[model samples]
Target: MSRIMVIGSLNMDIVSRVENYPLPGETIKGIKTDVNPGGKGANQAVAIARAGGNVSMVGAIGTDVFGDQLLEALQQENIETNNIIRKEGTSGLAVITVDSKGSNSIILLEGANGLLSMDDLTDILPEAIKDPANIFLLQNEVPWETTKNIIESLSASNASIYLNPAPAQHIPTEIISKLTGIFLNEIEATIITGLSVIDQESASAAAEKLIAYGVTEVIITLGEKGSLYRDFREHVYFTPGRKVNAMDTTAAGDTFIGAYLASKQQGYSIEASLEYATAAAALTVSREGAQKSIPYQEEILQFLT
Candidate 1:
C-alpha cells in the first residue's frame, strides 16, 4: 500500500438535520442533532484509511473531551496519530446544518486548528518528505502561513503534494505551481479563478485558467454533476457523477479526494481513479455524518462492480 500523509485540521462537528434551510432571520425546527468527528483533513485521512491506504495524520487538537474523541476516532480508523499535537484549549469545531435533500451549510471555528504553526511542522515533515514515494495531502483548514511553509519546505522533495483548497483562499502563483494535483468544488474553483463555474463549458474554462497558473493538474468537482479534470499537457475530461439518493453530503468531497489519491497511489490510471472516487463519494452521500459515511475499499469495489 502507498503511504499517505494528511496535514490539516481536526474538528468535532455539531450537526443538525432540518426540513429546509432557514432564510435570513428565519427560525426552523431541527429534526435531530448528532455530534461527529470531522474536519477536512481528518475526513480525508479517514477516507484514505477506510479505502485501504496506509495513512498518517498530522495536526493539532485541544485537551478538551472533544479532542480526545477526535484522536480516538482517527486511531479507530487505523490512521497514525503519533504526530498529532494536543494543546491546552478547545478543539476546532464545525456547526453544520443538513436539509432534507442532503445539502449542507457549515460555520467553522478554528480553535486549536488555528494554533498550528511552522514550529509544529518542522519536526514531523522533514522525515516524511525524505521519501519520494510518500504523498502529502493538504487543505486550507489550517492557517495559511502554516500551509505555505510546509509547501515551501517540500517543494524540492520528490513526494507528491495534493491540495484541496476548500473554503478557498488566495494562494500565490509560485506555491500553486508546486502542487502535484488540486481538488476543489465549483464554488472553490470560482473563488480561485474569478470565473463562474455554473456549466461544463465554464468549469472547463476555469480549470484551464488554473493550469495556466502553473499547476500540474486541476480537478473541479461539481456536486451531483461529477468532476472535471485538466492537466498541464492540455488533457481535459469530465467524469459523470454516480446517481444515488443523497442522505447527507457531508464529507462527500473529502471522500472523493481521498479515494482518488489512494487509487492513484495504488497505480490506477487517472480515469480509473476518478471512477473509483466518484463511486466512493456516491456511497458517502447515501449515509450520514463525516468519517462515519465514508465507505471501505470493499464496499466501493462492490458498488463499482
Candidate 2:
C-alpha cells in the first residue's frame, strides 16, 4: 500500500443547517447544528485510511478540549498522528453553514493551525518522508513559507508532492512551479491566475497559466459541473458531475482528493481514478459533516456501479 503524508490543518467544524443562506446582514433560522472533527488535512487523511491506504498526518493542535477530541477521532480512523504539535492555544475552527441545496459557506479561524512554523514541521516526519513509497499531500492551511521550506527540502526520497491550493492566497510563483501535482477549484484557479473561470474555456486558460508556473499535472474541480484534468502528456480529460440528492456539501472536495490518491496508489488508470473519486464526492455531498460523511471504498464502488 502507498503511504500518504498529509501536512496541513486540523479543526473542529461547527456546522449549522439552514433553509437558505442569509443575505447580507439578514437573519435566517437554522434547522439544526452539529460539531464535527474536520479540517482539509484531517478529512483527506481519514478518507485515505478509510479507503484502505496507509496514512500519516503532520499538523498543529491547541491544548483545548476540541483538540483532544479531534486527535482521538483521527486515531480512531487509524491515522498516525505522532507528528502533530500541540501548542498553547485553541485549535482551528470552521464555522460552516449549509443550505437546503447542499451548498455551503465557511468562515475559518486559523487558531493553532496558523502557529505551525518551518522549524516545527521540518524534522517531525523526516523518517517518514525518506521512504520512497510515501506521497506528500500539502494544503494552504498553514503558513506558505513553512510549506515552501518543506517542499524545497524534500529531496531525501522519491516521494511525489501533491499540492491542494485551497483557500487560495498569494504564493511565490517559483515554489508553485515545483509541485508534481496541483488541485484547485474554479474560483481558486481564477484568483491565482487573475482570470475569469466561469466556463471550461476559462478553466483551460487558467490551467495553462498554472502549468506555465511549473506544476506537472492539474485537476480543476467544478462543483455540480464535474472536473477537468491536464497533464504533461498533452492529454485533457473531463468528467461530468454525477447527479445526486445532495444534503450537505462539507468536505466533498477533500473526499475527492483522498479517493483519487487512493485509487492512484492502487495502480488504477487516471480515468478510472477520476471516475472513482467523482463517485466518492457525489456520496459525500449527499450526507452531512466532513469526515463523518466519507463513504467507504465499497460504498463508492457501489455508487459508481
Model 2 earns a TM-score of 0.91
Task: Compute each candidate's TM-score over C-alphas.
Answer: 0.93, 0.91
Candidate lDDT values, in order:
0.91, 0.86
Worst 10 residues of 2 by lDDT: 150-159
Candidate 1 Cα errors over 4 Å, as ranges: 18-30, 98-105
TM-score of candidate 1 against the unseen true structure: 0.93
Number of the top-ranking candidate, with lDDT as the measure: 1
How far residue 39's Cα lies from its native spot in candidate 1, in Å, is 0.4
- Stretches off by above 4 angstroms in model 2 are 17-31, 97-105, 155-158
Expressed as tens digits, the lDDT of each residue in 1-305 for candidate 1 is: 55899999999999898999989999988999999999999999999988888899999999999999999999999899999998789999999888887678888999899999999877898889767889999999999999988887887775689899987887778888889888989888888889999867889999898899888999998999999999999988899999998877879999999999888888889999999999999999999678899999999999999
Best by TM-score: 1
Report the C-alpha lDDT of model 2 over 1-305, residue by residue, as the tens digit. Answer: 66889999999999898998888999878899999999989999999887767888999999999999999999998999999999898999999888887677889998889999978865765777666778899998988877888788663354589988877876567877778888889878888888888777777777788788877888989998998888877678888889999876778999999999988988889999999999999999999678999999889888887
